[model samples]
Target: MGAKAYFAVAAAAISLSIVAATPAIAAPRAAENYVAMGDSYDSGVGTRTYDSSSGDCRRSPVAYAPLWAKANSPASFTFIACSGARTPDVQKQADQLTSSVSLISLSVGGNDVGFASVLTSCQLGSDQSCFDKVAEAVNQARTTLPAKLDATYSKIKSKAPSAKVVVFNYPRLFDLGTCGLGGLSKAKRERLNQAADTLSGIISGRVSAAGFRFADLRDRFNGHGICSSAEWLNGLSWPINESYHPNTNGHSQGYLAAFKAAIG
Candidate 1:
């Protein structure tokens, strides 16, 4: 073979080897027809900024879902989650789903187990009352919530069978640490956190059974509960409805972070 031809062949082989050794850049996540559904946590209840058109639902622009939509610029984005929404309300929200939807994010079941009421009772009533309320909520979470969650998930699947649904569980509200005056007693806080754990387990289990991704926020929001030095959750804020929900920081740092991890 000619020296010039041999040199050209060697250079081609070297170029091929370099190409093979270089890592491929990961493609960006595909845009989708994305829908956000569920309750107050998903609706941005504690964020204060809300869309007037959402009315009593109080959907906030800064909530995790909208933040995700704003960042990703999905093919389509719909936010229908409402404050005070229970599992049945979620079933209705499923009506917004369609076969073309490619992504969904949901945070539900807290209201199904009357978490808001439990929090109110714990804060305003006696310690025993708090324990009693926590127990009741736990019982409901264990017994009836599974079926409600399963049915709601099924409805969403039926509506948008091709969508990738991600179910986000609630963070533990209390840090169980010292907080100056007017907070629940340590015993009450422990009970409430335990109840939250039970609920998280149930939701995670049901989400897995339904073949969907479960994003557990408890760990993500660790050291950021109501009593923490850098708290992400609210503690008895005004406009009482915002009392236990995630603040703007929580939605951006906690919920949005978890959702991105789950979807990725």
Candidate 2:
């Protein structure tokens, strides 16, 4: 073939190949299929430390979901986490899934029996049965949460059959350090985390049985828990008007790790 003709043909072929690799019309639609749901922490309450934004909900833009979704670029997100969301409440609030969705993230079980009040026990210098209280709470949630999650997953799969479900295990509240006004004992705080771990262990099975991904942040946030030097999780006396929630960096740190580790 003539030199000019050969060069022209090679350029055309290269252009065609690039177009094929790029897919001119039907890309994967990475921006859709992401939904974030849950309670006050999910709503990003304390990240801003009392930012006047997000209206009454105080949803921080730097919250976990947003940060995670941003990290997993090209992936769009639908955040529905509020200040007060129980498992049943989220079941009601989560949007109807459409055709396109890659992931759905949610955290719940705080408002079911008034989580703040329950946590208050730990905060109130009531270390006598803190572990026992945590155990009981986990047991109760174990009995009930599976049912709700099963229902929620059923509805989710019905619409976005291929979508991956990710359930976040709430991280540790207090490291072995003083907390609340009473100054919690390290042993008591450790017991609390252990209880949380127990709760996570039970829920992890349920999450897996339901074909979802369970992100375990307990180990990651071990030393940096509520009373840790870094203080990933908050205590009652946080700088933010919001109480006992992860800080901005904390959310991003934990959420991003969970997102990276989670495959559902």
TM values, all candidates: 0.92, 0.77
For model 1, the local distance difference test gives: 0.91
Q: Could you give candidate 2's per-residue lDDT for residues 104-182 as a string of tens digits? A: 7777765663546657676664677665666667667667766766776666667677777788877877777555555
Q: Which ten residues in a row have the lowest lDDT in candidate 1?
A: 24-33
Q: Could you tell me the lDDT of residue 132 within candidate 1?
A: 89
Each model's lDDT comes to 0.91, 0.71
Candidate 2 deviant stretches above 4 angstroms: 1-32, 49-56, 71-75, 129-132, 177-182, 238-241
Residue-by-residue lDDT tens digits, candidate 1, 128-164? 9988888889899989999999999999999999998
Best by TM-score: 1
